[model samples]
Target: MNMSIVKKLKALHQLALSLTCSALLSLPLVAETAWRIDTVASDLDFAWSLAFMPDGRFLVTERTGQLVILNADGSEAKRQAAALPDMFVAAQGGLLDVLLAADFDSSGRLFLSYSCGNLNANSTCLASAQLINDELTAIRPIFRAQPERRGAAHYGGRMVQLPDETLVLTLGDGFDYREQAQNKANHLGKTVRLTVDGAVPADNPFVNQAGIAGEIFTLGHRNVQGIVYDPQTGQLFSHEHGPKGGDELNLLSAGQNYGWPVATYGVDYTGARVSPYQRFVGMQDPLYVWTPSIAPAGMTLYQGALFPEWQGNIFVSALAGKALHRLQLTAGKVTAEQVLLADLATRLRDVRTGPDGAIYLLTDGAKGQLLRLLPN
Candidate 1:
């Protein structure tokens, strides 16, 4: 070979090697963080809610009216069957939500919501009890919706505590009686605010209104299964399931009507229009609405340190969608959205943030699982 040609070939080889090194350097030094589920516990029958105790133990509620306590690592600690109330276990009606009191460390009190009544009729009910020696003590009823109906579905039973330590409980519109959601005379499809002892708050919007339920904080919801309070902004957020479509996320305001059957973005299951208007003069519109329905169940505001990028966003558990939805909110409005755990192929019944900043989830089924999400 000629000397000049040999020099050219060596230079080309060096250039190719340099290009390859540059490309390798541009690659990420470490893999991007991914979510991983650690099955904390399993074999739960239709677990509806998961809450952490002050001592790092966790409580899981089975829809069949049982409470299961687990160790921090998700091992079975104890099962309290007698602690659960006499729930009317019909379709979608049973022991629904369980929550620790804001002052649980000192008070030892916990609250629960469930369906009550016999086959003829049933309604959503709230109760409180103290967990003493791993047994429920001083259990008593706090509130119950009036005029129980025959319908067995749409019992909204989610609870959240406000900054003032007051409680907010969601009630679903009886599937057969959605019109009652618009009537203040009933508790159907309403959110109620009460003191820790179940007394109506003096500042509640409907306290002085005649013929309206004194406990009512807001009216006109379909079947709200998710609720959360943001202490940073003092805002309350809730999501409810709609008929054929029209799942909604609303910034809950006192005394406001949410326009369920009156003004809805959804249609009936039979493909008929739910209402002629999407916005009524006095009804409030949702902050975000999902058409075709995500069947939002449990929700939490992500203020944990495990995922700094998820701070101030909303995490919602979707049942029918079988996914966890991350909703980006800026100044009370949803700016963007993303879906997580779509490949899990399980109906996510509830999502909660643990004391250690990890995410916890409850799967809904006869052989459900309690899952913990951590950095992979």
Candidate 2:
């Protein structure tokens, strides 16, 4: 072959190699992002809430008044029968939420919220205890909803601790007493703020009001199940179930009335109007409303590395809707919505982010499951 032709052929070969390298670099390393159930902790008896400890262990609450500790791999380590509270188990009433104290490592303290009383007379109550050697010791009541009423449902038992170490407990309007949500004198349908020790906060919205409960922070909420605080913005957000329809997600503020039965987008279970209006003067509006009702349960404002794209989004567990709903938020407003894990055909009860940046879920059933969601 001619010398010039040989050199040209070598140059062409180098260019081809470079092109191949470029093409390989542009190819996707991972084909897709998918969510999958990583583990089934057990056939839980109705997993209501899940919280992770600093050592990567987790505790799950069952609505039947059971507290279970599981290893990081979802293997049961111990079950604390003595931790069970004397709960009034009935329709929507029972042992509800469990949370670890912010200083749980140092104090060994945990909190539980449940319905305490018989079906004929019950109320939402908060209690604290020390967990030592698989047992909850020194259990004591911290707060209890006042004007205990007769009912089998509507115990808003979700609890959240703020950065200030103050606690917020949501109370439901006893199903038959929806009107009491508007009354500040009772704890019904209100979010009460208290110190970790259970005393009413000195700066609570109604602390100085003569006729109002000193613990009342906000009122007019109907069975709020999901409550979370955004540490980045210092804002509290909550979602509650409405009658028939009109589930709501609200940006909570001190002293604000989030209109419930008096001003709702939903109607009575019989399809009668709950209220002829969805808004009223002096009452705050929801940041978002689910017209058909999703039965919003557990919620968390996600800020994790598992899904960089999901940063700053909100994750909600849906019971009636039986799905996980993601809301993309911008400047405190939801800009988009997505439904996930609907095909599982299970009622999602709780959602939490793990230290590893993975997502966890609890299913609601007689034989529920603790599930972890991971990228596929």
Which candidate ranks first by lDDT, i.e. highest?
Answer: 1
Per residue, candidate 2 scores C-alpha lDDT tens digits across 262-318 of: 898889999888798888887877777886888999998888898888888889999
TM-score of each: 0.90, 0.90
Model 1 stretches astray by more than 4 angstroms: 1-33, 82-85
Q: In model 1, what are the clashing residue pairs, if there are any?
A: none
Q: Judge candidate 1 at residue 348 and give its lDDT.
A: 99
| Per-model lDDT | 0.84, 0.82
How close to the true structure is residue 256 of candidate 2, measured as C-alpha lDDT?
A: 79
RMSD of each: 16.3, 15.7
